[model samples]
Target chain A: MKDDLTDRILVVLSSVLMLTAVYMIFFYAPTERVMGIVQKIFYFHLPLAFMAFLSYFVAFVSGVLYLVKKDIKWDIIGSASVEIGVVFTTLVLITGSLWARPIWNTWWTWDPRLTSSLILWLIYVAYIILRMSVEQAERRATFCAVMAIVGFIDVPIVFLSARLWRTIHPVVIKSKSIDMEPAMISVLAISMAAFLLFWITLIRIRSRVDFMELRIRNLEKIKRGGME
Target chain B: MKNLTYLAAAYGIVWAGLFSYLWYILSKQNVLVGRIKALEGDD
Candidate 1:
């Protein structure tokens, strides 16, 4: 009961932070002289991309723990994080395309960064599909743990593609400096915090659902056996 | 102001995608809860 209350309070706090971040993006962040209004998309787009990577990293760690400990709880956390990460990555792709349409005058190009991000998204999609195809819970968890670890290899590639290859994507964080005004940087910091909170809340909710699902399935099996 | 449309589209897509996912998860949770309750009642 106390845990449920804490979850609810965190959800409310995250929603408030999200709304404030949106307001800051529109009103507080200074507009870029070159890009004008479209530059505001940077506030949300970059944060979403960061959160996606963070979530996937969490999934990777959870996957490793699951393999090492052979605990179903770790599997639940791994799967939940991946599910949330996929949603954030999809938004990252969509917002990136939208921002590009006006700036680059093209929706997409097969740049290394873009292509690698797409591949990362596809790999996680495969992860979910793999989970759906399996029946036995233990086998499903083992396969998914291994697949999550394998899929995580794409994350570093996606992060490094802009630097490692010739790409049209703008590198925001260089080796020594970030090229953004103070206002923009502040708003981005708040937005990233908001999104991180939102990610944690979603992961908690998702893991609970996964637990309930497993329990219901066990209950059904027990009932069937009793009837027989 | 020139690229305002693109900005709006980007923000709209982000919020809509998030809300839609939240709704989907909540709906699934509600269904599972109901089923669990029914099963418990039967037991």
Candidate 2:
């Protein structure tokens, strides 16, 4: 009953948080002068990138849990994090392209950030494909655990590769040294909050769906006399 | 012309892409929920 209630609360909270985010982005946030309307992409792009990073970090932690405890829940969490990470990363890529068209005068580029992100995306895609290839659950989970651990090594690399290479992606949005207006900073903070809420809600919903599917599969196997 | 066109393109792409993703997630959830229902019936 407690778990059911938690799920319900999460469902409601996610809806409300998303609605609020939409409202804040469209109404409260001031249009950027330099990027103009295109600047709105920053609100979503930065948040998606941050959440993608968080998702991979979650995968890394859960990967450790899987290795230590050998708990299937840990494996499930790791897999779910990877899946969500991929989705957000894809969004980041798309939004980056939109931002790039205006700022860079190109749809795509071979810049360090863009290149590294594409590499990270491919690596996780391979991990998912690897998960699907194996027949046995235990073997698949074990293999994926290893892959998840290895995959996380690339997260920091992707994040810093751009900075290290001195790529054109802005180093900081608003800084005390070269500060944006106070109002801009406040708006950015609110946007970040909204995005974080969005990420947590998405992960919770996906995790529940993952759990339910696993339960269904188990029941199916039992009904078939452990055939699968 | 170039600056104005780029701004319009950026907004268009952002909204269109997000809408597509939102649709994708909804359709996927719908499919998964159907699977859940079928499994419940089977048991």
**Best candidate, TM-score:** 1
Report the C-alpha lDDT of model 2 over B8-42, residue by residue, as the tens digit: 56446644654465455546656777887887787
Kindly list the per-residue Cα lDDT of model 1 for residues A1-228, writing each as its tens digit.
575687678778888998999899888888889888898888888889888898788889988999999999999999998999899999999999988898899999999999999999999999999999999888999999998899999999999999999998999888898888888888889988888888887887788899999999899999999999
Highest-lDDT candidate: 1
Alpha-carbon runs more than 4 Å astray in model 1: A1-4
Candidate 2, position A224, lDDT:
85
Q: TM-score of predicted model 1?
A: 0.95
Q: CA lDDT of each candidate?
A: 0.89, 0.74
TM-score versus the correct structure, for each prediction:
0.95, 0.81
Clashing pairs in 1: none
- Name model 2 segments beyond 4 Å from true: A1-33, A173-179, A226-228, B1-43
For A24-94, candidate 2 gives per-residue lDDT tens digits of 76677787777776676776677778888898889889888898998999888888888878887887888
DockQ of all models, two decimals each? 0.84, 0.33
